[model samples]
Target chain A: MNGVRTIFGREIASYFTSLFAYLIAAAVLLITGILFINNIGRSQDQVAPNPAAIPDFFAFALIFFAPLLTMRLLAEERREGTLELLLTSPTSDSSIVIGKFAGAWAYYTIILAITFVYQVILLNISQGQTDLAHALCAYIGIWLYGGACLAVGMVFSAATDNQIVAAFLASAALFLLWIGDRVGEVIPNINVARFIRELTLQSHYASSFAVGLLRAEDIVFFAGIIAVMLFITIRLVESNRWR
Target chain B: MIEVKDLSKRYGDRLAVNAISFKAQPGEIVGLLGPNGAGKTTTMRMLTGFMPPTSGSAAIGGFDVVEDSFEARSRVGYLPERVPLYPDMTTEGYVTFWAKLRGVRQPAQAARAVLERLHLDDRSKTLVRNLSKGMRQRLGLAQALVHNPPVIILDEPTIGIDPQQVIEVRETIAALRQSHTVLISTHILSEAEQICDRVIIINQGKIVAQGKPGDLRKKLNAANLESVFLQMVNKDKRA
Candidate 1:
């Protein structure tokens, strides 16, 4: 746990010092701000409040955001040979993977928190007509959804030393997972496509959290993806010693 | 102290570090001399617990590197051939980060102490990207020493640094022989001959010769350590 804390502290500090992190954060906020106003204008005709604006935009935003934020997390360390320092230290491989995941998740949370200003404005303009519970559930879902996405990104980051390759691979995987459910339309088999859909990033978020209904299975699905991806990342990092 | 017996590392079908053995006692400095592909880095990597050996075993400060890696790691400080620094981090933050990773008590103070010892206290707030090549090597040395470990392993610490800084770094390393067991690998046989009490010459992933620098010169009947090294490496290649 000490190792985790040390690595976590270093990673957070790295994020704070880096221009890349700030650029991503700024881009996400700018795009989301535009989208929030656009969504609110459209929703005013049919409804008094629209709380899912942030999370809905984020579902697409995070596909790129998660991979970009995570591309340098491990891959840069390898390219810079700084991983030799971490691996040679007393720190365990598990601690390094968990620390990187936790750092990215923390950054995502901060960005997500900033977008809450949109919700506050909605509540004010609508005279508190906003369904606070609905927005809260979506926020929670996106929080874990973002976590799962970052963890998946880390697996690719750990797989390669080139930051561009890591980002590219992670984006490809996230894209597949986001749209994997649509495969059922082409496949004749229902069960297989359904299984593949269950393996995606969307099914877990769209049904339960997107509609303001939090289900146990969806929460479990996100948490499970985080755990399994982190596990694979640890394995990949450990395999470095062998190669 | 560091101890090893038949430490071997294999990468698939190729053996990068063949069965080799040596030890460095407290207050002694041992240099590992080898050609570029001669496995010095691989041997040091195994000793530092960065890589698990394919067979055999090593112990640092009485703890086995494989079975008790955390204990062993905490006792060993390693600087790889490349000076690994996070260009974004300040000098103090970099050393403090390493001190924390090594689980040292009062990491800030330890970082300060090491920086001072390395004559880097003045540059504590400077970004690593701005540091000169020599200062970067010293900063790397500071991280290796922050834990105050008994065993220090440095690989090619002077490879790219200027000659003046190389002398300073060598002076610093020689000062560590008071209590630390230092193992350094370098291509400059003259540098090794100056500071290393003993050296292990490796070729083709095998130990070709091992002894005190003076003793090695006498036994190999060479003009100097460099000539001795070439003769041994060539002889090993012909074998």
Candidate 2:
């Protein structure tokens, strides 16, 4: 536990200190902020616009954001030889994995918090017209979805010492999962389509959380993905000793 | 205390460390003297618990490096061929991070004290990226010693530093001989002759000879370990 805290503290401090993290934050804010203003800036003549589109679109952008956030977490360490220090230390491999994943997640959370300014604005502009439950559902869904994506990126980061390769692989994987529902629609069999749909990240959060639906199984889906990715990452890091 | 028996490491078809065995009793400075690609790094990695032996066993303070890895690792501090540094971290922060990972009771204090010992206290606030090569080498030593582990494993501890700094590091390591069992790998025969209580001359993944420098000097009727090394290798045509 002390290992976890120490690693976590260092990671968080590094994130705050590095220029890359700020570049990422500025980029996310630019995109999310633009989308927010564009939606609310819609004309009076148009049909009532769904304000939830901002967070939903942000979710689609996570195909890139999460990987960018996590690409350097392990890959850079491995390339720079710092991973040897971590590996040879007394700390358990699992603690190292969890601490890094948490560090990235916490930074993502701060990004999420910054983007929440849009929600606050949405609530203020609507003056009770906005569905608070709807926004809350979307927030919950995006948080877990972000964690899953970061965890996936972490696995790739551990797989190679190249940060670019890690980020590209994670993006490729997220892109496939993002369009999975569309691919499912073209399939001939209903059972196979349902199974594919069940596996797509977009299907889980966008369908349920975007419109104010919060099902237990949907939460489990994201949690399951996060847990499995984290488990695989821990194994990859531990392989330094045996493999 | 450190003990290795029949330790072997295979990377695919090649055997990087081929069933070599050695021991370092309490407070002895042992040198693994060899040229590049002599499996010194691989053997040191196995001893530090960074990698498992492909065939045999190693122990630190009675704890097996593989089976009791956590305990074994907790007792040994390792510095690899390349210094493991986070360019973003301050010198103090870097050592403290390693100390905490090693579960030291007072990480910051330990870091400061180790830095002071290495004559690096004034530079503690500098980012690791800003450190000179010699300072980086000493920082590596500081991180390895911050936890004050029973066994210290250093791979090429003075490979890149200036001669003056190398002398300082050698003295620091020699001082450690009073309390810590130190295993250092070096390609410089003179270095081994100067600081090591015993020199293990290894080549092509196997130890060609090992004994105190004086004993091997007289045994081979050579002026230094370098010629002794040449006599043994040239006379036997050993790999």
Candidate 3:
């Protein structure tokens, strides 16, 4: 537990020290802000089309940006030849993996939090007439979705030492998970398609929570994905120690 | 303090560290001398529990490296070839983090003492990325020593430091011999000769020679460790 905190603190400090974190934050905020403004400008239904759209934008944006945040968590350390320092430490591989994953998750959460300025604007314009429950549910879903994506990206970061390869692999993996259901639809087997859709980022996050309905299954599904992904990451790092 | 038996490593088809064995008792500074890609780093990695051996066993302080790694790791301090560190963290912060990760009970105090011993107390607040190569190396040593482990494994502890810093590191290592067992790897033969009580010359993933530096020198009938090392390495390649 202490080892995990040490690694987590180091990774989080490193993120702010470089330009990559700043750029990711700026890009996510700028893109989301622009999308929010456009949605408000084009609003014809007075309630901003869907209260969930703001959080939805964040979940969608994370498909591209969250991987960028986590790409170097382990891979860049290997590339820079510092993984030797890290791996040689007495800490367990799981602590290192979880620490790094948590750092990236915290960073993405901060980015998600900053977008609430859009919600404030929406609420102010309508004078408390907005659907606060629906907006909260969507926010919760986005939080869970982003957490899962960060875990998946962290696993890719552990598998390779090349930062570019890690980044590409992470992005590709998340992209598949994000759109796996749509791709699954074309397959001939219904069961396989159902499994893919059920396991996908979009499938669990889009319907119930997005519209103010907190289904127990959606929450469980996202939590399971995060746990399973982190477990795989831990195993990957441990294998490196032995290999 | 350390033992290995038939330890080997394979990266795909190429054998990085072939089946070989050696031992280091307490209070010995065993210098691992090898050319690049000669598997010194690989062997060190295995001993430190960073990488697993393909078909062998490594024991540190009687604990199997594979089975009781956490216990083995807790008793050893490792400094890698390149000295990876978080550049953004202050020197104090960096060592403290390492202490904590290594499960030091009083991380703050351990960090302070190590930093002071390494001549880094004044620079404790400086970000590691901004430190010079020598200072960075010192910081690396500080982290490794923070836990006060009985075993120290350093992979080229003075790779990029200036001459003065190299001398300082050597002196520090020499002083450390009073209490700890040390394993140091270096391509710089003279550095090994200066500090190592004994030297192990590895080539093509095998130990070609092992003994005190002077004994190896006398056996080879060479002027210095460099020539003896060269002769052995060249002979191994031809074989």
The prediction achieving the highest DockQ against the true structure is 1
Q: lDDT tens digits, residues B1-239, model 3?
A: 88989999998998888888898888888899999889999998988888878899999999888899888888889988878777777899889987888888999999999999999999989988799999999988988899998889998998888999999999999888888999999999998998999999999888899999999999989999999999999998787
Candidates sorted by TM-score, best first: 1, 2, 3
Clash-forming residue pairs, model 2: none
Q: What is the interface RMSD of each candidate, in Å?
A: 0.9, 1.4, 2.3
What tens digits encode model 2's per-residue C-alpha lDDT throughout A1-243? 887898889889999999988998898889877777777777245645465676687679899998998889889888888888888888888999999999999988888877877777777777767777788888888898889899999999999989999999999999888898676559988889888888998889878987889999999999999999999999988876665
On a 0 to 1 DockQ scale, where is model 1? 0.86
Residue-wise C-alpha lDDT for candidate 1, range B17-88, written one tens digit per residue: 899999889999999999998999999999999989999999999899999999999999889989999999
User: Chain A TM-score of model 3 versus the true structure?
Assistant: 0.92
- Candidates by DockQ, descending order: 1, 2, 3
What is residue A189's positional error in candidate 2, in angstroms?
4.1
Location of the lowest summed lDDT over 10 successive residues in candidate 2 chain B: B230-239
lDDT of each: 0.91, 0.89, 0.85
Tens digits of per-residue lDDT, candidate 3, A61-118, equal: 7777877887778787767766666776777777888888888888777778888777
Error of 3 at B77 (Å): 1.2
CAPRI tier of model 1: high
Q: Please tell me which model should have the higher lDDT, number 2 or number 3.
A: 2
